[model samples]
Each structure stands twice: as C-alpha cells, then as structure tokens.
Target: MGANLILVANDEVASDPLQQKLMKATAESSGAEIRFFSLEKTIQIIGRAADRQKIFIVVKTPKDVKVLVDGGVPIDEINVGNMHFAPGKKELTKKVYVDQSDKDDLHYLKTKGINVYIQDVPGDHKTEINF
Candidate 1:
C-alpha cells in the first residue's frame, strides 16, 4: 500500500492555521505531501459564476493532496470509506451547509479507480477531502 494523502478545506482565514499545523504534522508523521487549493480560487480558475455553487473535488494522493477553502460554499459532511466528516458553517455567515451525499458521484469516482478519504474539522480545524 502507498502512503495516504489528506485534503483539507476550510474558510480562508479560519482554515489557514489548521492547514499549516496539519501540513507540518503530516510531513513529520506520515511524510505526506500537502497541496493547498482554494475553492474560491477554483471558481476563479474555472471561470464560473460566484453566485452559482460549485462542487470542488479535493483529492488526496500518495504524493500530494488537493484542498478547497472557500468562504462562499458551506460543506457540512463528507464520507470516505471508514472515515467521515461533519462540520458547520461560520456563525456570522448563516450558510446552510449540506453534506456531500451524492453516491453516484462517488460511484463514478470508484469506477475511475480513485482512492478517497474525507474528514471534518471543528471550529479550530478546517474540513477537507482526501483521496
């Protein structure tokens, strides 16, 4: 088996510290590579409308992990095999975050032979997807 990859997602401000901490920890413990990607940045990169919601894919690999930290999108729960993630939105934003409950999408990922893991961080930590 290969080394695991961990993806982290969060609000830009709130998630930065935790992502750094997690990166350090992962580097020290698992020798994992961490890649930071912003959902907001992805939106800008993809040239999508900010008002329309987009589902960003954060994948973890043996070499690195992809992260999506967007202030606009609210993510509540994510699942990956034995691991599961649950988190709420910022109190000030009043966003109704929803769980990633799309099995067909997951099934497609499975069909594509991808490995994924999911995690949620509380107020102090940022939630992110892994693959």
Candidate 2:
C-alpha cells in the first residue's frame, strides 16, 4: 500500500496541540516525513514529491494551490475547517490575508462557485485587504 498523505489546517495548531504532537511523533517514528507549513509552504513541498512516502501537515485553512492538485502526490487526505461547512463566515474576511499578489487562489475559488474581488494598489507587493 502507498503511504498516507495528511493535511492539517493551521487553525488546528493551537487548539489541537495534542493531535498535532501525536501526528508529528507518529510520522517521525515510522521514518516517514511530516511537513508543517503555511498554505504556501505546503504547496511548495507538494511540488517536490517524487514517489516518496510523504505527509503534509498544514496548520492552515485549505485554499487552491497548483502544487496540491497538480503535484504527483495523490492528495489522499486533507483535514481542515470546523464542523460547520462554512466556519466563521462573517469573521473570515477580517481574519484571512492574501500574502501574495498571485491570483491562482482567487481563480481556484471562482471556479468553484465562489466570488472574489481584488483592487489594485500602488507599490503593493502583497495586496492588503480586510478580507
């Protein structure tokens, strides 16, 4: 059987320390690898997959990244979000930030029936927005 691919959302880091610790320990024990990265970092790692047994532990929300889907990795498991399908909708726009100007994420969401609006600002490498 192939190795497992695990994705842990960032929100779980502080609230689910025990589970995070256990996953880390287990991956280390099995000589498998565990990577804890932001959504961006996780996507970067996914690009490096080359048939190795890999597990990605993302302590962040799930967003669209080319590497996650296009990378050869099966992306067998992704653990994110709360019990609610749309958690903290009202507060999300305030809490999340767009770290880079790249709109791959925006495109991904739009394709999935989500709406996103972007405003151009001068000299803004990372566009800052309330949402």
Candidate 3:
C-alpha cells in the first residue's frame, strides 16, 4: 500500500479554501495518499499500530507537536516547514524562527528523543516568510 500523509491543523487552516487547495496540490505531487484531520482525530489515529507504519504527519505548530508527543504518538523525527517569522522570534535557521515557547517545545521533543529538522522546500529559501 502507498504511504499515508496526515496533516493536522487548527480551524483556521481547515476553514481556508486556499490552504485546503494547496494541501491537496502538494499531496498530489508527493504521490502519497493524504488525509486531513483535526488535532483530536490525529491524536486518536497516531496510537494505532495498523496506522503507524505508513504515516507521516504534518502539524502546524510546536504546540501541536507537543500534543502529539503527549498523546503517545511514536514520532521519532519531525520536519518543520512553512513557518512564518514574527517579531520577537529568534532565527534558528534560514527556514525556522522560534519564540521562547517554541524553543521550549523543541527542547522537550529533543529530550524525548525526537529528531527535529528544518524542512527545505523549493522556493522556501528565497522568501523571508518561509511559507
């Protein structure tokens, strides 16, 4: 079977037609079967053995990553992409910016043995927004 790519996000992303359209386009290009879920549903699915092997999850925020980790999701690594820079956020890399809380969360994940990387997508390096 093909791998499953799960995208978990908040209501803002769920309600945005453009975001939805873009997600679908990315999924199509990736050749993986893609699914969208609310954080609640994602938490439920992540613990299932049958669903774990072929799943790659994409979450919007560091808070969301913490939620998944707290829910006992077996995430060994995470790729963070499309992050937007805001005032008061420190630049972690060319594509990543973090506030104190975000840094804390990333540290927590690292302590829990999860590898986190800045995902490099085409055109992402060209923009300050990183979106």
Top lDDT hit = 3
Question: Which of the predicted structures, 1 or 2, would earn the higher TM-score when compared with the native?
Answer: 2
TM-score against truth, every candidate: 0.32, 0.34, 0.77
Report the C-alpha lDDT of model 1 over 1-131, residue by residue, as the tens digit: 13243334333522577766756675556454544555455434434424433333343321111222232323333333322334631121122222343344443444444443333322333323331
The per-residue C-alpha lDDT of model 1 at residue 62 equals: 15
- Which residue ranges in model 1 land beyond 4 Å of their true spot? 1-15, 39-79, 85-100, 111-131
lDDT of 2 by residue, 28-112 (tens): 6645555454444555555565665445444333343334444333443332223122432332233343333323444554454
lDDT for model 1 comes to 0.37
lDDT of each: 0.37, 0.43, 0.70
lDDT of 3 by residue, 16-131 (tens): 77787788887887777666677777777666637455876777888888988887767887777666789998776766878888878877887887877664854443322222
Q: For candidate 1, which ten residues in a row score worst on lDDT?
A: 89-98
Model 2 C-alpha RMSD vs. true structure (Å) is 12.9
Clashes of 1: 3
TM-score of predicted model 1?
0.32
When 1 and 3 are scored with lDDT, the better candidate is 3
Note the residue pairs that clash in candidate 3. none
